[model samples]
Target: MISRLLLFGATGDLAGRFLLPALARLSADGRVPDGLQVVGSAHQDWDDRTFRSHVATRLQQHAGDVPIEARDALISRLRYRAVDLEAAGSVAAAVGAFDDGGDAVDRPAVAVYLALPPVLFPAVLGALGGADLPVGSRIAVEKPFGTDLTSAVALNELLTRVTGGVEEAAFRVDHFLGMPKVQALLDRHAPGRPLTPVWNSASIAQVDVLWEETLGLGGRADFYDRTGAVRDVMQNHMLQVLTLVAMEPPARQTEGELHAAKLELLRSVRVCSAAEVPFRTRRARYAAGTLAEPGATGGRAVPGYSDEDGVDPARGTETYAELLLELDTPRWTGTRFVLRTGKALGTARKGVALHFRTAAPACDPGDAERVAADRLWIELDAPLESRQPGVQVTAPGERAAYGQVLTDLLSGGSRLSVSGEEAEQAWRIVDPVLQAWARNAVPLLEYPAGGAGPPPLEQTAGSARG
Candidate 1:
């Protein structure tokens, strides 16, 4: 049982909404051990009192909305420390409060929740190490583990140097990976599933990840510029979604083993061969566009990438990217992993759609080949199946029910939740793709933001290169 929850960024976006309520729920449910202490750490020059006050405000904004009285009780457990990232040994010193009385925690079970930028990870890990957290301490890490493969490898190497090679203790969260349907896909649709037959080359034709955001980079423009949709979407989140949908099951269902097997699958992913990579990259920079928010007008003047400060306006930095990807794994060797992501879209969505090839005519010589096929859409937004008009139909045609995996994973930390190893492997596979973009002036198809990605994607059979 974790008694002390060390929050690295008390005032950050994630800590305010996600962590606060999550911890409040944990506290309310008694998952947190007694004498529970919440340590808020950041470079915010707030002293103990100011930091505690900040915590109270956060509670009001988050946990205090419903339980005002209980908010005080939970707020009482929170302590703010003015810890500097540059100051050595500050982490050890900041976390010392939980150990006010010797052995108060019995065993050091601290969850070091990191809400800082990805770059600060190594330094923070070092500070926490100096804190000398006892065994059973778990560290939570956010996405973009690395902007690319080399960066990811370097980060993992740095982590190993600090922890001296501890495995599975790191909670690398993609948030999307924590969904219940993702777990169900792993458990039910694995290699031996009855549905496996349809997902194979002879039956299934394509799979795609649709992750579109309705809002542009309001203040996060700088961060968004450096790591476009490639690192943000394809390299990490969507690839994790892709692998789960495409990878062959391991001999057994263990996290480490499964991830290692996934690494093998990704390694087989051809790195350089241009044809294998394809010329289907579509990227867009949003101009001032109308947001679909409740009160938006014809064009409410939302800022685009170029409008943001501290960014090169000439750079073709993509706010939207779409790639018709192909995997080397035998299960989905020929099928396309159609990926699409963009900022300033009309709607916010993140999910995968499985488009199955329609079955061939059985015995009727008169039956013509079908153009549009059936699809299984797993979505985060509104859940509905796609349907078309039928002849003489009394009611609308049957539509498939889109499922929500987010709600399931949020309530329970299922294993299908993207593991750190899987995140790293994803970076490993896409490293070549990024390098290809840099080394060669590959043509980039331009699509306006706030629209469907660069026209529709097209792929040719047996055209893949080594």
Candidate 2:
């Protein structure tokens, strides 16, 4: 078991809003080791006491479900270190004290999680490479693995070198994989299952993987302005969900087998050529308008994308993105997989909707609705529902996705982490659209901040719906 967790970017928004709360949940459930130590390292000048104070406040704010005792236990295990992450010697000296002193078999496992920006991965990883961590130590990195294909491959190479050439020793996290509902969706598609019969192109018309948000860039203009819609969710989270929906069931049903299957599926996805990019993709930015609150007739005013603080109007980044992708594989040849995401939309919708071809004409004239195409909607942030008969699964109410990620990190397992090849392939799948959008091969369109996203592309019209 991993007895020590070394967290980078410990004082960042991610740590406060998600990671620390997750740790508290794990502590409450007795999922973490009793003697586990948490070492938070950042550029902040805070001492151990100050860091703990911050953690306590975060727990109070974000982890209200956790008992006070568990919150205290998690806070008790925390220690703080101020380090210059770019300096190999400084990083080594700060984290070295946590190394267990004993025979290799008796030493406790240590896991390092980089919760910082992807831009810092190279330098921080280089520092860790020089730190000479314990042989069995594991490392986990947060998402947006890279800005593009080239950088992703380079980062993968760096991670391999840092972890003694063992690929699985480094975990590339995509928290969507940790959602219990998402896992349940994958489980349903196992070979010989009920869904197996209708899972392919011949039976399914389209698969729409969507993640729309009503909220605007809430002080994330620095990051959001750079990432936009595609890189922010489409490339990582949405693609991962699509893979689980589209990949063939592996023979062994193990992590390695599943990884290979997903990689194969990703590779089979036909990348948009320069000319095809404009026809298959759409990009848009949100304009100033009113955003409706959930279930309410009223709405609040929202600023346009370019007007958001820290935004660069010259960048022409899209707040909305849509891609009409197809796989060349036999099983999914004709079926379209629509990947769409947007911010400042009228409503928040997060789920995968599979539109199956209509089965047959209705026996009763009035039963046309029931005989229409079947849409199996696997909801990620809400309850799962299916238009046809199918199992509906919900995530565990007690734990969040981050808690599952922490569990996987502590277990030293690659089952829930993205592999290097997977990361590279994901980049390959989206890079062309990015390139085309950059050179204005595809015009950047606009829509009201709280309206449905920009008008659907001609190719994607009538296929994608909330």
My TM-score estimates for the predictions, one after another, are 0.81, 0.91
Per-residue lDDT of 193 in model 1:
49
* Model 2 stretches astray by more than 4 angstroms: 100-107, 294-297, 359-373, 383-399, 458-466
lDDT (C-alpha, whole model) for all candidates: 0.61, 0.82
lDDT comparing candidate 2 with the true structure: 0.82
Tens-digit lDDT string for candidate 2 (281-392): 8999999998765334466677888888899989999989999898989898889888889988887778877777875222223211232347666667653322322222
Candidate 2 lDDT for residue 464:
29
> Which has the greatest TM-score?
2
**Which of the numbered candidates is closest to the native, going by highest lDDT?**
2
Clashes of 1: 0
Local accuracy of candidate 1 as per-residue lDDT tens digits, 90-174: 8777767566454524556666777788878878877776776755566767777877767777777766655557654465666
User: Once model 2 is optimally superposed onto the true structure by TM-score, how far is the C-alpha of residue 223 displaced, in angstroms?
Assistant: 0.9
